[model samples]
Target: MATLPVLGGKVFLTDSGGAKHLVKAGCDIFMSTGVTHRLTEILGFAAGFALGFEGKDATHPGQRIKVSEMGTALLGQAVAKPVGSGKGTGLSVIIRKRKNWDDIAWRFTRQDGS
Candidate 1:
């Protein structure tokens, strides 16, 4: 089983192959692998569902799955791949600031110099 930590808004990546990577805080929202995993914290932990790779072509160094804050799901079929190889895999959820109307307006104005 794989495991990650959810502490202080920071993300920790741990694959089944004993590989560990600490993702910087405020970078990725959260992630899960294709195995029964855990999201540990200082006080306790939560279990995560396995994103099974039963019918996948690439196993280890699995496909990179990036989920945006807008609920948009992006698969790394033609883009970035994972770190290692195996039947185990994980997901990366991006934490992004939501754009507001004012932000959009400012961007538009800046682009048009109006």
Candidate 2:
């Protein structure tokens, strides 16, 4: 696990099963991959196999959210600045492993209004 110090506490990040040893922020995958065409193989094999978001557009990763146009664009209705309406409102994005092709198909179908 990699711990990033926050203002009040630390945020710990971990990858229990992946190949890389050190999970430093902004680390280029190629240097740490330790396999032939490992990056290329991963890219071809999966879309969201990434432990965290892709950082090519930005300089770093993990700790700081990518502050870029595509990032902003994802938050289609986000405010001029990402300020919480009040202190209690916490924003987050959670990714979990999905099971069954039907479950996945339903999501794609819903998006298509089919």
Candidate 3:
């Protein structure tokens, strides 16, 4: 059995020659010794329930999975600003101001802008 580092309170594990698995907090893994183990020990074999290996591939134990190229492009399109909008003059400005001011106007305006 292969084990990965705990990150964000979740553990990722993979078999020697098979699919990867994500083990969340409080989940139990049963060992071959007929004893139960938590996320700290060996994980039992899981088959037929593959979480697709597209954007979730990690090369090293603690390496983070990054947004795939297609995912990044799609996200950029989804949040793209309209043409002719002035730079740093919209919600970004409001957010910057709200960090220093707790006034009712700033709070309400930030909510509306968000």
Give the winner by lDDT: 2
Candidate 2 local distance difference test against the native: 0.45
| CA lDDT of each prediction against the hidden true structure | 0.37, 0.45, 0.35
Every candidate's CA RMSD: 19.8, 18.3, 21.2
Task: Sort the candidates on lDDT, descending order.
Answer: 2, 1, 3
Candidate 1 at residue 86, lDDT?
41
In the predicted model 1, the residue pairs found to clash are: 59-86, 60-85, 60-86, 61-84, 61-85
Q: Write the per-residue lDDT of candidate 3 for residues 1-114, one digit (tens) a residue.
A: 445556556554544235344544467642322233332233322211122111222333334543322212345475645333465322221112223333423111223475
State, as a TM-score between 0 and 1, how close model 3 is to the true structure.
Answer: 0.16
- For model 2, give the 10-residue run with minimal summed lDDT: 101-110
lDDT of 2 by residue, 13-45 (tens): 665467544344555333344464576556644
Ten residues in sequence with the least summed lDDT for candidate 1: 45-54
Name model 1 segments beyond 4 Å from true.
1-78, 83-88, 94-106, 110-114
Q: In candidate 3, which residue ranges exceed 4 Å CA deviation?
A: 8-10, 28-114
Off by over 4 Å in 2: 1-36, 48-91, 99-114
Assess candidate 3 and give its lDDT. Answer: 0.35
